[model samples]
Target: MKAAVLFEAKQPLSIEEVTIAKPAAHEVLIRTVAVGVCRSDLHFVDGAYPHAMPTIPGHEAAGVVEAVGEEVRCVKVGDHVVTCLSAYCGQCEYCVTGRMSLCIDAAVRRPKGAPPRLMLGDVPVAQMLNLSAYAELMLVHEHACVAIDRDMPLDRAALLGCAVTTGAGAVFNTTDVTPGETVCVVGCGGIGLAAVNAAKIAGAGRIIALDPVPEKRAMAEKLGATHSFDSAAETVADEVVALTRGGVHHAIEAVGRPQSAATAVKVLRRGGTATILGMMPLGEKVGLSAMDLLAGKRLQGGLMGSNRFPVDIPRLVDFYLRGLLDLDTIIADRLPLDRINEAFDELRRGETTRSVVTFG
Candidate 1:
């Protein structure tokens, strides 16, 4: 199987003939169909987040199950599925308490001294976030993926794995934006756009989309934003407060930058919560002013949108099929796996919503 292998930080991923092992107990092997090129992967590529070398980085993906190992009753060999990075161990406290995304048990992974799931010749290739979907085939724990309807297109379903799950789940699960509430989503990339669309679906009274890119702001409006603004504006936060006559009920930080997170906090009304969905630089601190604390303003991180993938993903697919969720507009381009670097280049340019790498 061919995969884009990252040999070093701040370097391009080279296409190599990698070997994928068969599923271990509780694991499933999938034939990659489509995977989204996300900024999170770019962070690792640029060395913002350090990882073991010679790893496969792609995660947001959907595919067909080619095989399943023992105890993998959640899916069958011919099922269609979407992969998630938040693989959980069913017995963990987090999973039992209904917070499956926070499960960090090693039970889902192979024990030490066990043969690796992937190899390049004689060397082991580390899997990125459990599901290394950049390769032609992915071997992951059955808990990392959930079977979805066959009618859903793989390209669009891929987004549901990460971008959509994170964005939409932030609204539905994290912030729980009630009808008639105001929401301001920072960044109009794939995640931000999904938040805007989900805010609309949640019946947010005033959906505000913020981004420096004009085209993305326009796209947000088409999806559901009642208003849009250039995040680059010096007084953008003030402008949002003024427009809402105070501040929004919920503010989502999707840009994964300190400045964007600050803006999200700044645009929140009293008692409002700011959900940080983007993965900011490690060790970077985000906090509230003394005044904000007094005002009951809260800031929280929504890891993987606080998702329970087994239940959330299937419903999301239904939302798309019902025409309530717009995955088509969020997709900007589709390229073959070999051209994956070009997709990253576009992401670095800060243009385009999402670029998907397709396997043919």
Candidate 2:
């Protein structure tokens, strides 16, 4: 199997002939179909986030189950599925309490001393976030993926894995915006666009989309934003407050920058919550001002959009099929796996909404 292998930080991933092991107990092997090139993966590639070397980094993906371990029952050999990074151990407190996204149990991976799931010759290749979909195939815990309706196109279904799940899930699960509420989404990339679309579905009275890029702002309006703004403008915060006549009911930070997070907090109305969906720099801190805290403004992180993948993903698929969610508009380009680096380059340029790497 050929995979893009990242041997070190701040370096390009090289295509290599990697070997994939068969499924272990509770694991499933999937034939990669389509995977989204996300900024999160770029974070690791650029060393914004640290990870073990010689790892395969792609995560947002959908594929067909080619095989399953003896104990795997959630999916069969022929099922179509979407892979999620938030693999959970059902017995963990987080999982039992309905917070499956927070589960960090090691049971999902092979025990120490066990043979590696992937290898390049004699060296082990670390898997990124449980599902390394950049490769031709992926071996992951059954809990990391959920079978979806076959009718859902695998390419679009790939978006549901991360960008869609994180963005839409933040609206539906994290903030729970009520009808007539105002929402301001920072950044108009894949995640931000999905939030805009979900805000519309949630019946937000006013949906504000912010991005430095004019094209992205226009895309946001096409999806659902009632207003669009240049995020790089000096008075963007003041503009948002002025347009809303005070501040928005919910503000989402999807750019993963300190400045963007601050803008999200700045645009929130009293008692409003700011959900940070982007993965910021590891040591960076985000906080509300003392005055804002007194005003009941709150800030929180929405990891993987507080997802419960088994339930949320299938419903998301239905939403797309019903034309309620616009995955089609979010996708900007589709490239073969070998051209994965070009997709990342576009992301660095902040010129595309979402780029997908498709396998044969």
Candidate 3:
């Protein structure tokens, strides 16, 4: 299999041939079709996030199941599926209680001391997430994927594997935005645009999109944002509050940062809830005033849109098929696997929304 391996922080991923292990009883093997580039991957690339080196760095992907382990029944060989890094152990307290995203036992990847999923000769390469979709193949636990309609294009379905689900999920499941409400999403990247579209579908009376990039802001408007702005300047929250009369019913922080997290909090109405969808650094603290809690403002984090993939992925696919979800527009371009380095280059230059690497 061919994979783009991360060898150093702030360095380009090098393409290399690697060996992919087969599936275990609880796993499935997939022939990778399309993998979407993500900001989280960029964080690890730029040293903003920490991880083991020589990693196969990709999670958002869609492909066809080539084989399944003995115990796997959700999908079969020849079934098209979208891969998720979320592997939930059904027996966990969180999983049993409906908060599957918080299932501590699930998504507990391979044991720490074991050989990683990808390897170059004898050199082990860790997977960025449980699903190392950057490669031509993936051997992942069955719980880390959801079977989708075969007709959905692999490129678009790949977004559902991560950004789409994370963004739309935060709005639909986490914050539970109600109709006639107002929303402000800070960051007009892929996730932020998904939030804006989700907000529109949720019947939000006002949707404000904020970002430092003009192209992103424009894209957000096309995705259903009623207004857009350059958030590079401060006072964005104040502007949002002023425009919404009092404040928005909900705010989403899609950029992983303390400033954006705080801004997501500051722009809400008295009882409004803020959902931080951004993947914040592992140990970095999000400063919040103790007084804010007393004021009835709430802050919460979400993982993978708090998704139950079997249910959500299908609904998202239907939405896309029915012309509700905008995957084609969101996909700025597609590149062959060998051009994986170019995909990352476009991401760094902010030249595209998502650059999917296709198996060629």
What overall lDDT goes with each candidate model? 0.95, 0.95, 0.85
- Clash counts for all predictions: 0, 0, 2
How does residue 21 of candidate 1 score in lDDT?
90
TM-score of each: 0.99, 0.99, 0.94
Candidate 1 contains a number of clashing pairs equal to: 0
The candidate, 2 or 3, that scores higher on lDDT is 2
Window of ten residues with lowest summed lDDT in model 3: 106-115
Candidate 1 CA-lDDT value:
0.95
List of clashing residue pairs for candidate 1:
none
lDDT of 1 by residue, 1-360 (tens): 999999999888899999999888999999999999999999999999999989999999999999999988999999999999999999989999999999999998889999999999999999899988899999999999999999999999999999999999999999999999999999999999999999999999999999999999999999999999999999999999999999999999999999999999999999999999988999998999999999999999999989999999999999999999999999999999889888888999999999999998
Error of 3 at 71 (Å): 1.3
